[model samples]
Target: MKVLVIGATGYAGHRIATALRRRGHDVTGLTRDLAGAGARALAAAEIRPVAGELADPAGYREHLWDADVVVHTAMDYADPAGSDRALIAELVAAPRHLVYTTGISLHGRVDTPELDEESPSSPDNPLHFRYQLERELIASGLPHTIVRPAFLYGHDSRTSQLGRWFAAPRFVGDKDKRWSFVHVDDLAEAYVRIVERADAPLGDIFVIGEENPPPALEVFTAAFRAAGHAGEVTVHPISPEEWLEQAADQDERVNSAKARRELGWTPRHAGPIAGMATYYAAWQAANA
Candidate 1:
């Protein structure tokens, strides 16, 4: 299959592009700056690059023209409205499947341990605009699917809550505040599978992640110790209000069983807890 991935330079997009290539698909990664486009990563995956701006239709149209499927891995997209509308128009005109990458944060501040798809939608999340628009478009009868993935972690992933533990004096969350994460490769597989089966009456929303969600502090402390941080790991429990204020503005948890059952998608990474040590080792090496 031929596919075009927007934001292929990002942490998630890069891994997704590689997963598609490994599965024998012809992948073109769209990037604005080819110079910093993780050339080494793309080459390793055998995926080609298409330099262009995602917010501009003309810039992306050339690359989207003949793609069998367009998996949009872009996030905090500069022009989410315009880019989504334009791409939806393009994909609808050609009748190709389009996958929009959303986050669990769309569900709003998670004051609890877990949230499934049945959880009531949050009308108050400040980031709800784009997700709402994308949901509206998917319901507009266009060939589209919404993929809401949780904290993404994997190869060449420059950012991970676990990765932060490599640095000492890391702010560990309450010892039992749980969060979910998905491997980038697994997310890419889910995207590709959905695109391939586009004709099978696909779903409108799919969350991707491992079944296990670990306590935030435990995960980070393990990473800290693994990274050879000599200082004793500390757990600082913050109130929900304080958490919302201190933590980076993003979602905390997501459910992935829908995708697992429908698309046969299952994350290969050992969820967040098991992967902490590995992430710490990688982080330490990279930083050293």
Candidate 2:
């Protein structure tokens, strides 16, 4: 299968492109620059890079015309509408198997419990325009599967929840504040499996993630230990009335039973704490 992957430079997009290529699918990375980070990270696959941004659908026509499936994982923080509109337009014309990425944050930070695909989504997060773009796409009724993943963590991911604590030594309220997350590799495979299943229903929504997410305090404390520090870690518990001030409130916790049954997907790694020591060791070697 010839696959077209947009935002091939992002955390999820890069992983999906690599996984698809390894599965023997010919991949074309659609991005602003073939020589940029996303393309560079995919050096192992040596995928062909199309030097066009998603905001310019006309530029992606040649690449889109040749794809058997399309996975869009890119985001334009500055102008999400433009990029999203472009991608939707392209999909409307060529409605092959399509997968779009969204985050659990759209549902706001839920700390009391974890949320699933069926859980009520806030969709009114104060972040930016991308959530609005997601709303538009869902209503468009294009043949596609929308994947909403919890916080995604993996090696070398600077923006991940774990990475932030490791790189910066700060603690949010209540270290035991629980949350769910999916590893980058696992989330990548979920998209691949979704695209492979031609018999799956249209307008499908799958929450791709591991079932047992860890608590914030415990994971960060272990990370500090891995960094050779034993400072008295604090677990600042956010007040019930102050949940909105917290970073992530995805308390309902995400589940992947549907993906596992329908897409044949499973996560390889457990929660981040289980492998904190191992990841820290690798971090030392890579940063050294």
Candidate 3:
């Protein structure tokens, strides 16, 4: 299948593009600037890049004929609803299916409690905006798949939540900070399987996660250990909203059972501690 990964330059979309291409599909990456990071990342991965803004329907529609599936990993952080409303019509009309990426943050905060697709979601956090986008798209009657992934962790300096701690051990109070997680590569592969599976049901929301998501404190401690700064680690007064700050109150657990049962997605990275160690090593190598 010819796949178009909108926001192909991003952490998730870029990986998805490469994964599909490696699997022998013709993959195209759509990014804001052909000369920008997304384009460069796609080019580096050998996925064809199309320079276009997702908000402008006409900007990408010309190439729509070439895409059998369109995966939207672009999050319009500002005005996500308007962006969704603008593109939903065009996106649904073109592709056989559209894959929308949402995150476990939508489920709000949970401390090791198992939550699935049927669980209720909290709309009071930052994800409230994207939740609106998800609703609008699902109601469009388009053959669409919603992929809700846990916190994404990887070597990418921009996304690795471990980066700040690894650079230097800092004191964060309490271990209450917790979050569900999925390795970036694993999350990307889940998207690929969702598209490849012919029987994947439309309007199905798949939460992609692993068997265990480490507590926020453990993840930070692991990062410090990986960086040889574990000795300096200290905990004092960690904010309840440790990652996203006070306004972004979230501590959540989400399971990817649906993705595993239907799409056959088996995430390779199991333990967050070990994953953070590996991610730290990769970050050091890339930054070196």
In model 2, the Cα lDDT at residue 117 comes to 64
lDDT of 1 by residue, 1-288 (tens): 998888777778877787778778899888776666375567657888777877665666767877877888775446767767776766666676677787676666556556666554466766667567766776667776787777777554565555544554465344555667787777888877887773577446787776556666666666666666777666565456653324434336666777878888887778655666676566567667
TM-score of each: 0.83, 0.86, 0.87
lDDT per residue as tens, model 2, 117-144: 6655454544324456667787887777
- Highest lDDT against the true fold, candidate: 3
- The lDDT ranking, best first, is 3, 2, 1
RMSD of 1: 3.5
After superposing candidate 2, which stretches have Cα over 4 Å from the reference? 109-112, 127-132, 235-247, 250-252, 286-288
For candidate 3, the lDDT comes to: 0.73
lDDT of 2: 0.72
Computed on alpha carbons, the lDDT of every model, listed in order, comes to: 0.68, 0.72, 0.73
Q: In model 3, which residue pairs have backbone atoms overlapping below 3 Å?
A: 9-38, 109-251, 110-251, 110-252, 173-236, 173-237, 173-238
